[model samples]
Target: MAKRIVIEHCSGCDKHSWGTKHDEAKYSSLAMNIASDIEGEASVRNIKLEVEINPPLDRKRFVPKKSESLQHVYFDKEKKKDIRYPRLGAFEIHYVEGTSVAKVLFSKIEAHRFPSRHDVTSALERIGLYSPAKDEEEGRYMDGDDTHRSSSERSSHNEDFTAVRMDFLTKYVSPLGYEGEEEVKKMTVGPPRAPTPEPEPEPEPEAKPDEKAEEKAEEKAEEKA
Candidate 1:
């Protein structure tokens, strides 16, 4: 069966786009795994893999395609304006076997949950296909820090690529409808913000020994008189 996997790398702050061809062997392996998983008991042989890469966009942030769902939207209540966000980087893996077609999504999240397929996620991380927004966040913390390194240097770090895979097989690809497909996995945007620390209590002032002594003396004198 011949399969085509389209890895779409959307534009990020870096304004660069990448495709599956960058790492053909890795993508091929991924395709095989997906095929086997989808086929189940059925035999899969003589599989052909094709990868298509999309060009980078000029703008940092752009509206998502109609088919792609928006993960988050920032609305300014005070300004009464919508805060535009940069377009997120993503990967669209399409698996086609004859007339049947299946699709999946690797979306960039602010804080991506651990992917269901560690191998798939690791494969993507091995390459430079990651979210630029995540890179920027790490860069902010990396500044003046000795423990952290640049995004390029951390290519092998699976912890950095916080992207979730949207399994389209359930809703879009399955011929039997969404009954048998696994539930879609959810990815968190970022870590929860730390709570504000409460203020410390003020120290109590100490009484002066001189003032006490003076009061005592005055009292004694009054009693004597």
Candidate 2:
């Protein structure tokens, strides 16, 4: 597969479809993106954006703009979403699309004109994705000032709301399934009598860097000799 850098799957970026630009054979466009929060723990940030490359005026580098889909997922101002590290990576509640992008159903995120930590948290919490709190504080999300944030806020024990929704997809929704092929073949009855499947032969390793260089030097020496 060809490799290409893509800023997709980044919450604040715009969605770039491979309608005509798709080059699976020559270039496998990057499907996933890298995201992180203020603490920089690779947390998912919900940025309602699509990918829009700014044609280079100088042709040196192209910067992509975060264009709006013109959607909005607002939260109650009284909810107080001024905290850091939203509960879930990004939104995973109710995808507004008539159908889901993947097999998993995700919550729709309405974009803000400018998504600050405050605005993003508000939207995330609206879809039940803000960072988790005590079970007793179900109604509340977090403090506005980010003062009471935990030292382990990066890896908080809060319920991963997005994962909870995905659990349904993995257990029953996906055709591939969580179990193996043999497990899938059997449903109610046991097939324990079946012998263990043979492991697939590994592909030959790539030529080592040092060996290649030595071979090149030997070839040169042979020509000189």
Candidate 3:
């Protein structure tokens, strides 16, 4: 857990903005941790955030895909294993130095690659990440289909690259839902972490007793006059 975290974002690096437009809060949450010590300054050329979110699962099922015209996802009767979520938490980004992120922090910190869209929420929750937005922006998370609708899937079983394929298997192939995947063992992930938000600076001290009384006496005499 980080008592204080700084995103130290770089316009030079491309991965920070993985998807979507007009959304920085989504990415800021990536840089944020559990620590409330999130107050700080950065060399950021600009700062913006997106409080976008994916909606609560409707508990839909993966029915056979219709033709291109009918390939939309809908709520059906197949029940996915009920997944327990953690207590809610806050999420945001901090601006820090680029060199600090690449050299000092990233390698030492453990990271997890979400195998599926389903896995994204779990991993984020496990790590204390939250949706910056609560209302309309909820459930707007983009998935494999959202990112790639050009090539249709023969089966919902295999799609996207290695990560997506692994995720699909975790959902369909494994008896134990996502938690019961073999790839999970191979993945060396970090423990639950919450970086502190920036700490508020300590306030300046009050004036001395003499200074306070002297100012008060002056006001009193002025009022009398």
Q: Which candidate comes out best when scored by TM-score?
A: 1
TM-score of each: 0.25, 0.19, 0.17
Model 2 earns a TM-score of: 0.19
Candidate 1 regions exceeding 4 Å error are 9-50, 55-91, 98-205, 211-224
lDDT of 1 by residue, 96-166 (tens): 34445454544324223211343333343344233336545655212111224555654333342223223
Query: What does candidate 3's lDDT look like per residue over 61-153, in tens digits?
Result: 434334443323333445533221110121222222322321222210122221233333333333444332421143222232232232242
Candidate 2, 1-225: lDDT as tens digits: 221111112222223343423222111111111122311211222334232111112212222223354222223235533221111123222222222222222221333111223333344455443444431243332322233354445233233323222322333223322233334234313355778899999999996689888999999999999
**Cα deviation in Å at residue 163, candidate 2?**
30
Minimal lDDT window, size 10, model 3: 36-45
Work out how many backbone clashes candidate 2 has.
19
Q: lDDT for each of the candidates?
A: 0.38, 0.30, 0.32
